[model samples]
Target: MTRVCRLVAAALAITVPAGALVAKPAPKRAVAKVDWTRTFGTTSAGGYVVGNPKAKVQVIEYGSLTCPHCRHFAATAVKPLLANYVRTGKASYEFRTFVLNGIDLAATLVARCNGPAHFFPMADQLYATQPTWSGKVEKLSQADQDKLNALPQPQMMVSIAKTTGLLPIAASHGIPTAKAQQCLTSQAQADGLMQMIKGGEELGVQGTPTIFVNGKKVPAFDWASLEPFLKEAGS
Candidate 1:
């Protein structure tokens, strides 16, 4: 019976250290992946920052809300910048509002009225809706324009924001009418925005969409030109 059992076991190819003939291979380790795109922070200067805070490559842009060039940059770069670079935890992006005029000031005020969480999303929407709002501004009557120019900065900003059809955009993006009113009417907030313009000038930013990579200004202003620098920076 023992002889027969030994032969059967051999034939069946079943054996064990305890029960098995072959050892199983160890499982591969899982790498933890993080999507830094959804991570938003505020800089000491109040600019909205996105991505891995400690990433090697830091990107900064001094941009105007009303600038066509800045709108184009938002249209082209926001997605890729957040997804390819920021998502991988390789880089960070910061956008500082540089107000260029009354309309720009009003837009910036309203865009920031909600909170840091809504800032970027609102900025994306604002850029997407730029043409519609700007066109409305151009269609303003001469007398109305003169009246706007005559008013003080705060009230003028409120008027421009309303007349340019920008207030509705703000409302749609989570800013209540009362909040938008407060943003446009607040002297303190308006001064804070003016400080942004001053800060941009101090950085020698002469135009809209001025970008800095790793603390150095890149000569290129658009996304296509900026992508190569980001790649070279390990992004």
Candidate 2:
């Protein structure tokens, strides 16, 4: 028998009565306390901020909804950053939408529709499912593609959102189909996203997943490069 089994058997033999049935020990429950210091809000620049409002280091990430690199970074780096730096009040993180196309704009609209409380979570969900939805658009028929392109920008975005499965993804995130469609068609939301894209350009953002620390752009884009800047700024 294995060492663990032997230990269990020894304990059971010592604790049980001669004629009694052996009872299994209960599973240990996880008791880790959740950290609630992380907070969220919309920025004047039309971005979403998550973490301590008064943190010493400020980290801003310019990301696109349909960008694969952005999706990878969100999946791999964001949670650790939130846990180690943001939760510890060493840094504040902000994510600004840098719409790369009509589909990106549509996705951002649905993500922002649920307000600050749900913004980050919705964005995370969109990034996580980016491949599945984007793949659907890649496989569309030529005639259907042309039809989508023929519509006006707003209508085209709504059509793309529905066709590419983005609407369903949004619906799964507690945004109803009607609400998602309305957000996709909202000119105000579209313009706001556009303004943020322009703002990113003005800040010299040349690509998705651009990192800024304390109002200064980081030379490299990955989390490995960005973390040191955050530590230096926080120090």
Candidate 3:
């Protein structure tokens, strides 16, 4: 059994019916195994970038698209900070995927479906509309257990992603074919994502949306309080 699947099983054992308990199976996917290439500097699909290339502060967020906390940060804090700092070349931001489940991975794929140029915009939209889509996940999952519960599950993911404006962008960008391919099939990229998660752990990140300033970890969420740190990083 893959470590992640075992972890998932351990978690499900508590919430699911007794019949759901079973030996953990290897995840059908080892990690995304796709050929990925970036056509621009500081821009990669399924990733993020902001601020000047020479900016001293490099903030990397390892987030799941479906995570409410991540969405909250994007909506309530990150947006304003991006406008102030990222647009002014004072700080840079990057997002790495950390899939918590099949549904989360599906949502990530949809967010990345617009390639790099539209990735963050799609993500921003997703975060903005998170509550609506998040509520339907359970309803959508139960509608067709076979169709939805199956691994490599599609699970009305497109429907939910569309609510966030990603579908239209997908149509415009030709579905971020290469980027989505990289995310869904590339073992190396998957491993790289895992490494980022490990890096976050080493930095004492116990939850999603942990913020950093100038490569130094910040332990709080209050934007007003973090201003001094941002000022120093921006300097």
Candidate 4:
């Protein structure tokens, strides 16, 4: 079996809810759900934009693909927020990735593997399962980091892609052939990522899953704390 299938099976062994059968690979559907034009950017490191173009509050989330905190936010908070706010034109959302390590870069490449249409869905899936893959490095010793760091870029990407439940065949089909590889090695994308990191720094965002509403930081993770800020912005 491929590495991806192995990682996915390992994850399912743990998280497959009681009495529920393992979920099969979803159907290969047309990329119909996304508003492609809105996702466009002048540079290579473009992100998906969802919600009302005219919404008063613009929320930009700086996430790392390998970050467990980001996964929790995606699985536990983002879905509801998107349904309640983004879909209703009350808010707009943008996801920017911070590639602090090779694993993060690999994961980012995979998330963009399926283009804009599958970007959000793939991102949600990766974050939901992040805990399983983000193994204990401190306990394992520095050798573990070396092993991860030693992998060739292509191999590293394939490994990260595996952890996200994507088969090699699926990646081949979904990812733009040249773009997939290009997105990883591109200097332009790297610069864009740096800018995002610096932008977050300037905004006083100190951690993963940090949220900003109308240029003001929401100091907590829970939506209840953030809702008040939204109300204030919307008003």
102-212, model 2: which lDDT tens digit per residue?
Answer: 778777888888876677877887787788887777788998888888999879888888888877777777889898888888899888888998899999998988988
Off by over 4 Å in 1: 1-32
Q: For every model shown, what is its TM-score relative to the native structure?
A: 0.86, 0.81, 0.64, 0.66
Clashes per candidate, residues 3 or more apart or on different chains: 0, 0, 8, 1
Q: Give the alpha carbon lDDT tens digit for every residue of 1-235 in model 3.
A: 9999999989877766676668887778676532112221343433556556666666667677778878877766677667766666666677767677555665666555444556676677667766665555555545554555553423244434433344554545456544554444545544555666676677777777677776677753545755677777767
Candidate 4, lDDT over the whole model: 0.64
Candidate 3: stretches off by over 4 Å: 1-47, 141-147, 152-169, 172-192
- Ten-residue segment with the worst summed lDDT in candidate 1? 14-23
Order of candidate numbers by TM-score, starting with the best:
1, 2, 4, 3
Return the top candidate by lDDT.
1
Flag the better candidate by lDDT, 1 or 2: 1
Two-way lDDT contest, 2 vs 4, winner? 2
Best candidate according to TM-score: 1
Give the winner by TM-score: 2 or 4.
2
218 in model 3: Cα distance from truth in Å? Answer: 0.5
* Model 4, span 1-235: residue lDDT tens: 9999999889878865675876778899885564322442222225556666677877767778777777777766677677777766778777777666766776676566555556776666666656545443323457755775577766655554454334442354466545565665555655666777777777676778787677676764656666677778888
Error (Å) of candidate 1 at residue 60 is 0.4
Model 1's alpha-carbon lDDT is: 0.84
Clashing residue pairs in candidate 4 are 4-162
